[model samples]
Structures are given as C-alpha cells and as structure tokens.
Target chain A: MKNLLFFIFIHVSLFAHGVATGDQGYIQQINGINFVPFMYLGAKHMVTGYDHILFLVGVIFFLYRLRDIGIYVTLFAIGHSSTLIFGVFADIHINAYIIDAIIGLSVVYKALDNLGAYQQWFGMQPNTKITTLIFGLFHGFGLATKIIEFDMDPNGLLTNLIAFNVGVEIGQLLALSAILILISYWRKQPSFITYSYSTNIVLMILGFMLTGNQLIGYFNS
Target chain B: MFNAQQPTEKDLPTSAQLLKSTIIAILVTIILLVMVILPAEYGTDPTGVGKLLGLKEMGDIKMSLLEESQNELSQENNTSSIDSDSLDKAMVNNTINNDVVEITIEPGKAIEIKLEIKSGSLVQYEWKTIKGGLNYNLHGDGYKGSQKFISYKKGRMVQSDSGELQAEFDGYHGWFWRNREEFSVTVILQTSGDYIQIKQML
Candidate 1:
C-alpha cells in the first residue's frame, strides 16, 4: 500500500504542469475550428491544475460564509477571464516560466495570509480581494501562454477561444463545489482546529516547490 | 450556508512563532528542491542524492524528449518558410514521374529510402511488403546535416500503404521499413512526384 501510494505521488508530480502527451499531439494535428475538443482541453487543464487549485484552497481557507466565498471566487473568475481573453487576442507574449513562478508566489502569499503571518509580521492586512484579482490575472496569463505555445490554426479561433473560456469557468465551478464539500466535512471534525495550521504549512511548501520548479525551467530553457 | 468559525486574533500565532514557521517551510522547500526535484525533473544532480535515488535517469529521458519535440517544432517552421519560397518560384515543370525501387530486408533489419524534395513539392507513393508485415516510419530530415527530423506517419505490422506526401521543407523525405518478423521481407516502392533525386540511404 505504501509503495502504491508512492508510485501514485511520483506519477502525479511528473504530470503536474504538462498537457498529456496524447492531447498535445491532438492539438498539433488538428486544423480549423474544434470547439468541443478545445473546450474539453480547457476543462481538463483546470481540473488538473495543481497551482490554481492550491491558490483557490488558500483563498477559501478562512472564509466561513458561502456568500463571502461566492464573492471572492467571482472576483477571481473575472480577473482571470479578462486577462485570458485579452492577452490571447492582443498577442501579448510573456515568458511562461516567469508568469508561472508568479502564480506560484500567489499561492505562497495566500498560504501565508491564511496562517496570519502577514498580520503578525507586518501588523497590517493586505486587501485580500484586490490581491486575489491581481493574482488571478497572472494565472490567466499562465494559461494564455500555454495555449499560445500550440500555434493553433486561426480558423474559428475566436469561437474556439470563447468555448475554451466557458469550459474553464464550468471546470472552476465543479472544482470549487468539490473543494467546498471536502472542507465543510473537515470543519465538522474535532481535528480541524489542530490540523488547519499544518495544512497551510504544507500548502506553503507546495507553493515553494512550484516556484522553484518554474524557475529551474526558465533557466534551463 | 456552512458557518465555520474563523480564528480570532488571539488564536493566531505570535510574530516570532509565525516567523519560525515560515523559516521552516522555506527550509523544507529548499531541501526537497535540491535533493529530489532538480535531479528528477532536469537531471541536475548537484547534491548527488538524486543519483543514489535512481531519479537522474528519469530526468535525463525527460530532457531528451523535450529537446526532440522542440527540434520537431523548429523543423516545421523551417519547412513552412521553404514552402512559401517554393510557391513564389512556381516550379510547375519540376515534377518527376514513375520512380520505382525494390529492396530486400533480412529479418530484424531496417532500411531507408529518401527522396530529395523541396518544401511544397507533392509526391504520391505506394509501398508493399511481399512477405511478412513490416513496421514503417514516414519521416523527413533537414538539408545538409541540419539534424532536424519530423515524423509524418508511423505504423506497425503494415503490409502496404499508399498516400500523398507534401514536403514541409527542403529535406530528404522518406520511408524507413523494419522487418521485425523471423523471415526476410521484400519492399516494392513506387513513387512519382516533384523531387530531384531518390536513393537508398543504406
């Protein structure tokens, strides 16, 4: 059982930031408009995106009310959508590694905020909503840069992109619902108070791993 | 409408404690990155621990695959540029016709037939194995030992195939057939196209 779990962990880590090889081949070979496949790809991207999921988990860690969670998640959605649509259309190119590192830093920032480190170290709270929105933009750029790497055929480009964006939103909703369910169940347990702090620490470590990984990629590339 | 309690200020950690936790997180991250991630993802084993762990081989394979894929992408771009040049030149009279060749391959051996074709040139080809099926790769390589390669198609246990191939760049475009069966196989190739030369590449 331990070996199986270790094998799973290694497999997941290897694919953490990559499109599956078969899907990558499909993307390269296809020509013209492919709405459904692109949309599916978008959804798959979000469902497997560890960095985005980590940041979202950190954002909602402290929120207890559903209304507050909704508001925060919406802000994040809008922030990412704007950049994803505009960045691709405008052909705004950013180095993927740099943007992904920033995304990792966003995760780290949220984990620290959840730990109340900012309040203790700096004696002030950074406006959480604005920061979420800003980081959301960076996350969107990460997605956009990856798509740009495909050099996709321009036929039906706009419609395909829109479909992909819609798929991302749907994927976000599904992921959020699953996370909310898990968190709500965990909160009811007596261990919640004891384990919450440790969880954030783990999250911070993951953020650092992501950052380090991307920085290494940047230099290697 | 779940209402979980948020920790108040008094329940939060003190400044020194927060600092300590942050430092610990950083330290753990650094150790993992240096000892595991670097060697497993990029084959960069600075601390030598990854080599001992047998992860350096995995990293090496990943890096080489990445390099190969990047080379394929560059080759595509190079061919596309050559395609435009071919269009501008309008080589309508350059088409060659009915170039036929046959080669015998022993069991567990491979052979290649390459055509010197420019980007945008079109060719029609048909090949058949007389005996057992053979594995084949339709691929191209860049001009003058540029080392750029792109695979157009590949198959296993193929007895025959026929299709049109448009050159992506100025390169040697060809078929590689490997007879994997226990018996020898004879491949009869018929090609007619806009190409300068055709030869067996050993």
Candidate 2:
C-alpha cells in the first residue's frame, strides 16, 4: 500500500500539467460526430486522472452511509458537469496550471476536513457538502481547461461533450467502487484508528506537492 | 451511519502541531519541486538529481515533441486551407482525360514520357513495372530559355508510383523510368489529366 501510494504520487506529479500528446492529436484532427471515440477519451481521462481520484478518496474517506455518499457524489457530478459543458460551449478559458493548482487545493481541503483541522485550528466547522460541490465545479473547469487546449472540432460539439460527460461519470463510478472496497476493508482493521491520521497527513502532503508543482509550471509557462 | 457530531479535541491536532505539519508539508513540497518537479517537468535541474536519473532529458524530449507536433498541426491547417482554395478554382473549366500506355524496355535501358501541359494544370497518374522495380524521376522543363529543369520527385528501385501532380509552369511534364534489371520489363502508365498530348522521348 505504501509502495502504491508512492507510485501514484510520483506518476501524478510527473505528468500533472498536460494531457498525452497522441490523445491531443486525435482530439485536434477528428471531425463530426465522433461520439464513441470522444466518450472513450473522456472515460480514459477520468480513470487516469489521479487528482480527481485522490479528491474523491478523501471526500468519501469518513462517510459511512451510502445515502450520504450518493448525495455528495451527485452534488460533485452536477457541479463539475455544469462547468465542463458551460466552459467548453461558452468558450470560457482558464489557465490550466492555475486550475490544476486549485484542484490540488481541493484535495488538501478534504484531507484537512477529514483530520478535523478546521475545528482544531480555528474552532469552527465549515459546510463539507457545499464545499464539495464548489470544488466539483473547479474540477469540471480543470477538465474543461485541458479539453479546450485540444481545440476540438466544433462539429457535433454538444453531442460529443454530453457523451464525454457520461463517460466521465462512468469512470468516476468505477474508480469510486474500487476505492470503497479497499477503504471498507481497511476500516475493519485494528490499525485503522492508529493510521488514519497518518493517511490524512500524507494526503495533505500530496495535495501540497501537486499545488506546488502546478504553480511552478504556471510561472514558467 | 453518518457521524453527525463535530470533532472533539481527541479527533483534532493542536494549532501548533497543525502549523508545524503545514510548514513541513511546504518544505517537502519545495524540495520535491526543486529536486524532482523542475528537472522532470521543465528540464531545469538545480540539484542535478533529475539529470542523474535521466528525468531531465525525458522532460526536455516531451517539451520538444509537443512543440514539433503543434508546428506540424499549424502547417497542416495552412495547407488544407490552400487546398480548399485550389479545389474551388480547380472546379472551374477543368478538363480530365485518361490515357493508358504500355512500353517495354530492354535490360539496362531508359525512356522518358512527356505530357504537354499548361501551368497550374492538375494531373493524376500511376505507373508500374509489370515484373520488377526501376528508378524514376518526375520532372519538367519550362518552355522558354534559362529554366532548363525542375524536379517534382524521384524514387529508386520502385515498382509502382501514383499521385496527383500540379504543373508549376508551361512545360512538357512527365516521368523518366530506367530499368536496371537483367530482363526486359514492361511499364504500364495510366494518366488522367489536363494535358493535351503524350510524347515518348527515348
């Protein structure tokens, strides 16, 4: 598990700023109703998107109820989907590195929230649900920023975007399921209480690392 | 099953501890950025660790490759726009005529074929050796003095060639094929174009 976390940290930090070149090329060249291909691209992205997965893991780490999980996840989906569609169609552009840095912050926020850092340090508890939703919007815009850089063909843009969104949701569900199983089992272990703080601390560290990397990228770029 | 209560003191860290952790996280992030991220992402290796690990080169290659692809895409876009313009003009008063010619060349022999064409005329052509490969050159000479030759393309040890060609000047434009094989080879040339005549020049 330590090795895996280390691997993910290295992988995510290394290729954090951009999409794969071949995918970018395909997105740029293809025209007219490439629904299936676009959907596949979207699904592939979400599955491989470590930042999104990390944030999701943190968000659901403490939630024990399926209903609460569903509510939060749904809120996140709605938030991200709105901006993804709007940002692309309305031609709203944001610097990818800056948005990615904010996405990094989202992970840190959730980790800190899980650790009860707000209550401990500030003596106040912020609304986790609303915060999740807001960060979800930022996540969507993060994806939008990358997609817009592809300069995708405008033909069938709406259809392709919708299909892509569906694929993203599917990918998210798949990732969430795997994470749920692992955490559920971990919660059964006696070391859960002892290691939970350490895990959150690591998550926070990863968040800081991601943020720092992207900020460096932004300034250089 | 949701835990509704806010965190108790036991569930949280002290303010000083939290601050300490934050500072450590920041320091660690800076270290990673300097030793790993800089070299791996921007090929800017201050600590030389990235270069030692070859991560700096990896980043450099990625950056260069991306720039090259962007350059290629822009070039493709420019060419496609030009092609659309040419296609529009090509639709006006265009004439296409097809011709099939079979010529046999003896071993170590050569031949040239020319099509009388005006500048800016489009020709689609294909030529193949029935048995073996040959060296071929597609070229044109301007009708007037001082423009002796312009080469369009050339291939060696080629069995077949086919493509569209646009004449850049009023000239006799076509291909020269040389059979370097031991046996005589028959070349079948098929052409469809705006050319007026085909002349075989030995």
Candidate 3:
C-alpha cells in the first residue's frame, strides 16, 4: 500500500502543475535552440508522464514474461510513434480535448480488458492487437498536437522529434522497469491473485479520474 | 499470478526488515506530499519551465530520425512550417489554462499572458474582484490573426484555504483566473478590430 501511495504521489505531483498530456506550450523555446528544448522536454515529459504510465499499467498487467511485455509495448510504441511522426508532419489536427478524452478512454478500455470485462459482456473478444495498435495511434497523435503546438522549427524538426521519440522510448523503458518489478513481485505473494482485481479496479478509478479531469477542462475552456 | 519467486521466508527479510520497508515507504510518501503542498525554496527555478522526464525511449533513436528525415523532407515541408499554423490548431482546442487563474486590469482583449508567480499558495488561489463581475475571453484569434488564446476576465475569484486571506476584487471582462501558480499566462483577443491592452497593475 505504501508503495502504491508512493507511486501515485510521484504521478500526482508531476501533473498538479500543468495538464499531464503532452502539448506544445509545455515546451519553451529558450536561447533559440528551438526544437532542442522541445526534444529535451519530451524526454522529461515521458519519464514522468502519468497517463502514459496508466496505459502501461494496463498493458503489462497480465504479462509474466519480459519478452511478452517487450512485444506488446513495442507494438504500442510503433502505433503512437507512427502517428506522432506522421500526424504532425501531415498537419492532421484534431480537437486536443476530444483526442485526450479518447486517450483517457483508451486507459479505461485497457483496464476493463485486464479485468476480462469485454469477454464477460461481449462474448466474442475484440482483436487485442488491432485495438492496441489503433489506440497507440491516438496516443501518438495526442503528443503530436503538443509538438505541433510548440511551433517546432522545421529546420531541425525531424531530428529533434526523432530525438524526442527516442527519449520517449527510453522513458518508457525506465517506467516499465519499475512497473514490471512491482507487478512481478506482487505475483509471488499469496495475496497477488486476490488483489489483482482490486488493483485493476484502482486502475479503473485512476482512468476515470483522468477522463473526468480532461472533460471538465475541455468544457471549462 | 505466476512469475519469478518473491523473497520467501527462507530468503525473506527479517521481521525488522519488513517493518523498515513499510516505515520507509510511509515516510517517503509524507515527504513528497509536503514538497507538493508547500512552496519551493527561493531560487531561480523553472517551475515555468517543465522538467524533461521522457528519457527511456526506443533504441537507435538517432537512426530513426535519419530514416524519417529523408522520407519527410522529400514529401514536402511539414504543415507546421509557420507560426500561423500553430494558431489555427489553438482555435480548435477548448481547454482552460489549468495552470494559474488571472484578472486583467485593462478593458481590452488579452491575447497571450506570460506571468511568473511566486509559489506557496494553495491550488485554490483566485483573482479578487475590483469592479463588476469579471468576464473573460476563453480563447480566440488575435490581431495577428492567430488562434492564440484570447481571453477576458469573467466572474469573481474565491479563495478557499485553511487560513489564507482571499481578497475580493471588482473584475472586468479581461482577466485570466487559475489557482495553481508558477506558470505563464496567455490570453487571446476577446473582440476583433482592437489590439491587446495592458494595464499598469495586473
């Protein structure tokens, strides 16, 4: 429980300042380095990003093998990165709020899937891989909006965005390490099976918390 | 729920060890909450500037860039070639600046606000009234014809805290209001045909 509280405090602390999702204004162009600051900011944002963490929590909740976790995460990485790169480059803009709300919904979807809600209710399973790939696209586009928002310089945008994407991958690795460690250990304890349901329930609560906040901010604005 | 073996009794930590871990986690949580609720120490800090947190990204980060560069640069320049495109994207986004609230001291539209506030205030801080009810511009295109945030103050600010004094002020239609501080403020023009106005006091 303490560990859980500790993890949440870190997340809540980062988001309390500004919205947690990535966007342009989050990066400031200091000293005319232009996209460099954004690239650096992207690295930082991903390391501490809670929404990304939440999605990750759902993604890796059931995996027991490192290789399996890697495969799933890679799929997600490809999904978002492809969209993040192409979406901004193509100038396909969507309402950030709505996109974010959907991103929140993605979290909800994953948590529900973890709890086997889809099977109990839907009878037929949705294509998990396809859904992950699709949601990854939404997440990437979401960050791309922020990158686009930053008024990223074209001169080195490709380089910097690539750097940012790399940084995101790095951050994801680090975040996943901690999460995997926790989940792996929890699976050992006798209580692991008993608490799995509640853990995902907490994940659902966290997802709803995120969606609720974004919706309110969307409407208020 | 099968994975690597957890530290069992044979390899388990002592009773004191488990107790120590539990205590440490609790202590750490308390310390973090304090850091969050309290203000940062006086120093040049970039609460205004966010910390770059995304470090562990995909491998061969630079290689990916090289590959994409050729594909994209030849595909035609990216859409975000100009500052104007950014403004257009801003128009479609309808989220408040969840950072800090504001109250404009002027009587014109505020396009973008850049404010660096002193921290240590509750997330419940507000803009006191100085006149009639405060009115604000949500976000709109500025004279620059960009969808930059253009907001006027609206309604009044009410501060709810344990003991901090929440001053009441008469607000006009030109203030940005938020409780969280240590941020930059940007307001877009509320009306057309008028330039952004600035007052002596903010």
Candidate 4:
C-alpha cells in the first residue's frame, strides 16, 4: 500500500511537468552542452512517465524467463527506436493526441497478453515477439513526435541524440529495477498469485482509461 | 477440454536462468533500438517538404524560366530548398502565411483545378458506403473543412468507432482513403496557384 501510494505520487508529479501545452513552437535556450540536459530530460521523462511504466509492466508480465522478456522487449525497442530517431531526426509531423492514444492502447495490449485473453477469447496465441516489435514502433513514433516538438538545431545532432538515448536507457533501467523489486517482494506474499490476475486487470483498465481519455479529447475541444 | 495435464517443472525456466535472461534481454533490446534509430535521424528530412515544393530541382531550363530566377533568389538567402512556383503562388494568394508546402510528383506533371464553393469554401474528398450518397461516409483532410452540399443538413461530425482512419486535413497529408486504405502522411502547404498539389508516398 505504501508502495502504491508512492507510485501514485510519482505519477501525478511527473505528469504535471511532462504534460505541457501542445504548442511545438516554444523554443527554450539549450545550452551548448546539448547532450547532457536533453539526455537528462529524456531520461527523466521515461523514468517518471507512468504511461511508459504501465506498458513496460505489461511487456514483462507473462515472461517467466529472461530470454522471452528480451525477445519481446527488443522487438519493442527496435520499433520505437527506429521511429523515434528517424521520425524526429527526419522531422516527421504527427498529431500528438492520436499517437498518444495508440501508445495507451499498446499498454492494454500487453496486459491482455498477460491475462491470456487472446488464447482464451480467440483460441490462438499471437506471435508475442512480432506484436511487441510492432507496438514498439508505435511507441517510438510517439516519442519521436514529442522530441520533434522541439526545434532541434543541426549542430551535434548525433551527440545530443546519443545523450538523450543514453538517458532513456538509464531511466528504463531505474524504473525496471524498482518494478522488479516491488514485484519480487509481492511474489513472496500469499496473495501474489491472485494479485497477478488483478495486476493485469488493473493494467487493462488503465489502458482503457488512457485510450478513452485521448479519444474523448480528440472529439472534444 | 475441461482438465488437461499441466506441464512439468523441467519444462519451466529455472529461477537462475530467468534472472540472467531478463538482464540480458533489457541490454540487448536497448542496444538494438538505438542502432536502428540513430542513422535515420541523421539523414534526409522526413517531412519531405522540399519535395512537395519542388525545391531540389528548381534551377532547370524548365517551363516558365521561373525556376532559374527563383534559384538565384533562394541562393542569396542560403536556402537550397524553396520552390519557384510556390513563390509565385505566394505572391498571388497568401491564405496562410509562414507555411511552405513540399510535394513529390512525377516530373513535368502538376494537376490544376479551380474550386468554387456554392456555400462555404471548404472542400473535402471523402468515402461513402453507397459510393456517391452520404449514408455512411468518411471526410476531412483534402476536404479542408469543406461541405459536401447536403441539403439543409449540417455536415455530419461523428467520432470513429472502428478506428477506420483518424481525422485528416490537407490533400497531401493526414489520413485518407482513395478506396478505404489508410496512409500516414506529412503535409506541407502551398495555399495558392493551383488550389493544392498532392503527392502521395507510402
């Protein structure tokens, strides 16, 4: 419960800062040491992003082995990285809300996988590796959309991008580590097995919530 | 199908293996992602505006000799990408300022059409279940918030349930359907001359 409270606090605070008005033209002065700050910002965004964490949780939920986790995550990473770097670097203009809604649904997808919804409901197992990879591409594209919102300069593009990428990696590691710790401890409790089912249910609810919010936003205003 | 025998423990991953594999998976995924994204970032502009505006092939002994003169003007400004035709259009009609449209099309081919609105001047190309009638139809994007001339009825505005295609604007950009196929797009603006120039690339 304490952990849950802490998680909620982190989520609210992060969003308060991360959710900026959708004007892409706001130019802030980036210091010449471009790599560090941007990278830090990228990393911080990943670490503190609740939306990202929900998806990550779903990605790892069913995997009992590291190899499975690796394959799926790698697929996601590939999809996102390709789109993110390429999208922003290439300056592809995308709608922020629509992409985000898809991103929200990606979380639901993983949660559904965890719950064996596909197998039970449809009587088939989806190619988890491929789906993750495809969804990862969408996720990466969303990130790219956010980054492109910044009027990035041509100078030191590689270095700065590298820094930001590294920051993301660090943030992912941190978030994953914390999740591992919590889940590991939870797994020891009597309710762990029962909670596993609930975990996915909650995840799915959150995904629906996210998607619903984005869509309503799309139509409204 | 009620009760099948469960798999044995020998089939499941050992705890040690699980831990090792998870760590390695995270590392491998991150490395591969970065590797894929980095190169595409450093390369050409993804927005492809320069293509839409015909900036790259500006200075040729083509059509009106506007290309050569525009190239000289663009060179003075250190801009390697700005269409000569687009400049002329801008001088004539500037509906939206500070917007440049780049289009990719086959050489020496540009579509010309004049649009006259009986009601309001917004025009859109949309899809219909009955082909021509407005029973169940998709609209927006190239339609530019234009009306379909439905008698005394406000143009229908409904959110999509099937996720058919997201709301789109601009003929060359946004979600569109020639026959119900979705294409992600990047639209640049020209705003004059020949109403709009559309270049579709998958």
Candidate 5:
C-alpha cells in the first residue's frame, strides 16, 4: 500500500507536466510513413497517460466476466480511435486543457458510478456504456490535441495516425492486463472490501485533482 | 448478465470517509504541485523545495523553450510578410541618376556589386532576376581595413526589389546576389543615386 501510494504520487507529479520536449522534438522532426517509431510513441503515450488509466480502472472495477470487459474496452477503443482520427484529420481546434479537464471529469464520473453515488442519491443509474463511450471520445480528443500541438508534417499523416492508433490499442491492452492480474489477486484477500472502498475514494480524489489542475492551467494559459 | 456483479451498499464508503479521502487527495495534489509541477512546468516554485530537487531547472527550460519557439514562429511570419511592393512607391520620387548593371550569373555562383558613396547620401535602386529568383543581401562595408559592415536587407528567392537607402556611413553600398537556380540567370539592376563610384567588390 505504501509503495502504491509512492508510485501514485510520483506518477501524478510527472504526469502533470504533460509531454516532454524530447518526445515533442521527435514528433516535429519526423515525416512520411514513420510507422514503427510513431506507433511506438503512441503506445508509450497511452501507457504513461494517467488520465486514461484512472478511467480504465474505474471502468473495470466491477466487471468479473471477460465478455463484459471486452465489450466495454472495445467500445472505448472504438470511440477513442474514431475521434482521434477525425480530430486530427479534420483539424479540430479544441483547447487541450479543456479536453483534459473533461477527461478528468470522466474519471470522477466513473469512480462515482463505482461507488454507486449516482444510483443512491438520484435513484437512477446512467447508461454506463454510453457514458464510457462519450468519455472515450473526450479522451481521444485530448490525445489528438496533444499530437496537433506537435506540429507534425502532413506527409503520410494518415498512415502515421493509423499506426499510432494501433500502438494505443497495444498499450491499452498491456496496461489493462496488468491491472486485471493485480486486482484479481487482491480480490482474494480479506482486506479487499476495506481496500476497495479506500481505493475508489482515492480514485475519485485523483480524478478531482486532475480536473482541478487542468482547470487551473486553462485559466492561467 | 451484466448486472450480476454490481456491488452491494456495504461495498460503498460512508459519506464522511469519502469526504476525508477527497480532502487528503486534494492536499496531496497541492503539495505535489507546489513542490514539483509549478517548478517543472512554469518555473514558479513557491515552496523553494523544487529548487533543492533540481526540478526548477527543468521547468525553467520548458518555459523558455516554449517562449523561444513562439518567437521563432512570429519571426517567420514577419519575414514572410515582407513583399517587394512595400518600397516601390517610395523609390519613385527619389530618383536623381539612372545607372543599369546587367550581369549573367552562372548556376550556384554569386557576385557582389557595390557603389562607393558618402555618408547621408540618398540612393534609389531596383533589381530584378530576369530568369530566376535569387538570394540577395543589401549591405554596406566601410572603407578598406575598417572592417565595418551593416546589413540593409536580406531575402531568399527574391525575384525583384526596389528601395531607397540613406547611407549611414561613407562606404561601398549595394547588393550581393547568389543564383540558387540550376541554370544561369541574368540580373538587371537599375540605380538612381548620389554615389561617386560604382564597382564590383567581388
């Protein structure tokens, strides 16, 4: 638990800075069908994307079946992939900070849904799949905005984008499996119940933090 | 089937516990921002702890690089907006003497033609690439051994230019044209000015 807290703190601190200059230089300098490198970069981005991970964690917290997991994850992937391509190709100009804040709110929404807060307070359950897909669109737009800021060359852009999306899927799968394995083991412990509540609460708090940070950045910038 | 794994009310945290956890998370976030994010992103360190951790330099570099790149973009826009037509009207009224120099510059070759003029002398000059655009610089070099040089204008792929120049100091003043095209091209230069002499410096 202590190690996890340490990891979370470090991750949050590092993640708040956004994309590094080295990665940005790589993006700006490259052109044509740089499939492998762009794909690698895309995968690397998804893996390090704390916002995406937090949302994913909230999403699968209650799922026990592989089919259910597949359905939800695939929906998210579809939504994310479509918007990512469209946002970049259509030259969508939404501010990244705003999109990121919305992505943060998606995390908060999911955590609250996990805690059954909405169902309890309002005696209503929002459509989880649609909500997930919607947030996935926001997440995709967030990715698109960051890449657009990289000022990548237009040559072979479509091919590079497709390759990047593939990389994102690969990264997402790798991260999802790791979380699943860890959670499966934790579920067997007697402290799982106590820990789960605390964990979701923490997740919700992290979500709020992300939202607050991005909102502050938006106003300042 | 999807609803089977829904959590019971017992799995949820009490409102008080939730509020406490939220506060703790916010506190952690604030601490991290003060010590790390602000220093590393904006170069603003309120706690002074970021400097000790060497994160402040990272932030400083990021902020400076962003500002540098933005400045570069603006400079590019400014250069692109420099058109030959901006000085054409001004050059018409100041013409006093007309001298035309025509030269055929070979591919990948350059030539420097200058006019020896006195300080404060006014000159109206125009040049055009008859075949292809070339890179040109309008500059002044002081008298022999003085080592003084001043740039009046510089441009790339310019086809034509007309301007009136006021000599800042007594020196050889004029254009250096480099033919960047694959083939030879002729440059026609017309000048009307108060210069005492015209000669090819190089």
Candidate 6:
C-alpha cells in the first residue's frame, strides 16, 4: 500500500506536459518528415503520460466486457486523433496549462462516474461514452499545445502528425493490454469488490491534484 | 455478467453522503497540493512544511532552471528575427578592431569583461589561462531595462577556449572567469569583431 501511494505521488509531482528535453531538441532541429522518430516520440509520450493513463484507468474501471472496452477505446482514439491532427495542422494554439487542467478534470469526472457519485447526487447517470469522447478531445488539445511549443518544422507536417497519431494508438494498445490483464486478474479476488470504492476515491484525489497543479502553472505562467 | 455489478439502490450512499465524500476528497487534494506539490515543484512554501521536509530547495532549482531556459528561447527568437538591414548598419557603424587584455584573478576571486554588441552582430574570441585552470561562464545581459539573461556556455577547469559568439540581443555580452585554485590565474582574452566597446566590469 505504501509503495502504491509512493508511485502515485511521484506521478502527480512530475505531471508537467512537456516532452523530454533531448526529444524536444530533436523535434526542433529536424526539418523534413521524420516518420519513425516522431512515431517513437509519440509512443514515448503516451506511455509515460500519467494524466492520460489515469483517465484511461477511470474509463475502464468497471468495464468487464472486452467488446465494450473496444468500443469505448475506439471512440476515445477517434476523438483524440481528429483534434490532434486538426489542432496541429491549423496551429490552434490553446494554452497548455488550461487544456491540461481540463484533461485533469476529465479524470475527475470519470472517477466520480465510476464511484456512482453522479447517480446519487444528480439522480441520473451521465452518458459515459459521450463524456469519454469529449474529454479525449481535450486531451488531444493538451498534446497539440505542447507540440506547438516546440515550433516544429512545417515541412511534411501532415505525414509526421499522422505517424505520431499511429504511434499514440500503438502506445495506448500496449498500456491498455497491461491494465486489462491486471484488472482481470484482480477481479477474481473478493477484495476487488470491497476495495473498488476506495480505489476510485484515490483516483479522484489524483485527478484533483493534476487539476490543481495545472491551474497553479497557468496562473504563474 | 457483462460488466462489474452495479450497486443496488439500497447499497448506494445517500446524496448527502456522496457530497461528504466529495468534500473530503477536495480537502485531501488541497492539503497535499499546498503541503507537498507547491513546495516540491514550485518552491512556494506557505505553511513552512516544505522547508522542514527539504523539498523547497528542489523547487527553487527547478524554477531557476526554467527561467534560464525561457531566457535562452527568447534570445534565440530575437536573433533569428533580427532585420538584416539593421545588422548591416550596425556593423558598418561599429569599426572592427582587435583587442587583447590580460587580467589576473587571485585565488577564489572572479572577474568579468563585457563587450557592447548589437543583436545579430558576430565576434570571434580566444581566451586562455596562463596558470591553473579556471571556471568560466559566457553570458549576456539584455539592453535597456529588459531583465533578460542568456548563458551561452559554462565550463569548469578550462584552460583555453576559442569560439565565435553571435549576439542574441543588443546587450552586454561577456565572459566571467573565476579562479578556484590556491594560486592566482591570469586570463589572456583576445577579441575581434563588430562591437561598440569592450570594458572590464567592476
């Protein structure tokens, strides 16, 4: 339990929307379409992105069917890919801190939905699929703003963005596979039912932390 | 079952209870954000807990490094967008001259020499230490009241360095040398370029 808390703490503290410095330098220096490198960077960003992972975990927390998971994941991917490509191509530069804060709120929303808080509080269940897709859009904007900060070379930008999107999908698949396996294993235990409530509460807290951190950054910046 | 069993109505908490849980979550988030995240990441310690835990120092260093990088980015933008006509005019107005100056730094002492150069101007410089190696930083201060600082390069225990420096802004560009050895070190600095003036800063 202590180790788990420590892991979450580390993720929360280091949750700034930035590419690695070396990767950023490479992005700025390269002029033409560099398909493989950009794809690798995209995968790296997704695999290491705690905010995105947290949201994904929330979205799939109660999902027990593989088909449902596939549908939801596809919706998320489509939503994010549309915004990511369009946002970067049109140079729609939203403030990163603001977009990140919204992404954080998406995590909070999902965690609350998993806890059944909306049903109890508002007496109705919000459409989970729609919310997931919308939040995915915000997440893509967060990524787009970070990329814009690098001032990437315009040559072959579309092809590079497409490569990056494909890499993001690949990374999502890898991460989701691990998560699904772990959750499936855990579901066979009696403690899974007992501990589910507390787990969502912890997720909610992390969501709030991400939101608060980004807001502080927004104000300070 | 297609999914995890949904909680029955009887098992669900009351609306008030749900609100209470939310308030608790928010409270916990606020406490952690103020006590841990602010101090460890931003160096902002309001309740004094961060300093006690030795996290404020990390925050301070991160903030300074962020400032340094932002300054460098702005300097790069400034240099890249400099008007060629203005650069040419500045070069024509400033006569090219070679100057060699030698300064001695006693043990644990430091000295700085600055050249007044406009944005996009270029200068070639060579500096070598006569005795033991010294720590050196090549940096610049922005012109006027702009609170901009750019660090071009930094090195420790360097005996000699030769390079061409292009001004990123109209400012005082220079090298600061510090002798950490027990004995004094003399630095011979030779510079030739399009600059308005060169002087040792007191």
lDDT of 4 at A95: 79
What lDDT is reached at residue A137 by model 3? 92
User: Runs in model 4 with CA error above 4 Å?
Assistant: A1-27, A31-33, B1-202
TM-score of each: 0.56, 0.51, 0.49, 0.48, 0.53, 0.56
Q: Write the per-residue lDDT of candidate 1 for residues A80-183, one digit (tens) a residue.
A: 88888888888889999999999999988998888888778888878888998999899989888877875565767888788778878867876776676567
lDDT of 3 by residue, A12-99 (tens): 3222212121232122111123343444456556766788889988988877656767888999999989998998899888878878
RMSD of 1: 14.6
In the predicted model 1, the residue pairs found to clash are none
Model 5 CA RMSD to the hidden true structure, in angstroms: 15.9
What is every candidate's alpha-carbon RMSD to the true fold?
A: 14.6, 17.4, 18.8, 18.8, 15.9, 14.7
Docking quality tier of model 2: incorrect
Sorting all predicted structures by DockQ, with the top scorer first, yields 6, 5, 1, 2, 3, 4
Clashing pairs in 2: none
* Candidate 6 local lDDT, B1-202, one digit each (tens): 1124653445434556555655665676588579766875677999998777655644654564355445444543465443344345556678786899999998755677988788888999999988788867788876533645677886667899999999998877888776657799999999999897786753
* DockQ-based CAPRI category assigned to the predicted complex of candidate 4: incorrect
Superposed on the true chain A, the predicted chain A of model 5 yields a TM-score of: 0.89
DockQ for candidate 5 = 0.04
lDDT of 5: 0.73
lDDT of 3 at B163: 19
Per-residue error (Å), model 3, residue A55: 0.6
Model 1 has an lDDT value of 0.73
C-alpha lDDT (0 to 100) for residue A176 of candidate 5: 85
Model 4 residue A174 CA deviation (Å) reads 1.3
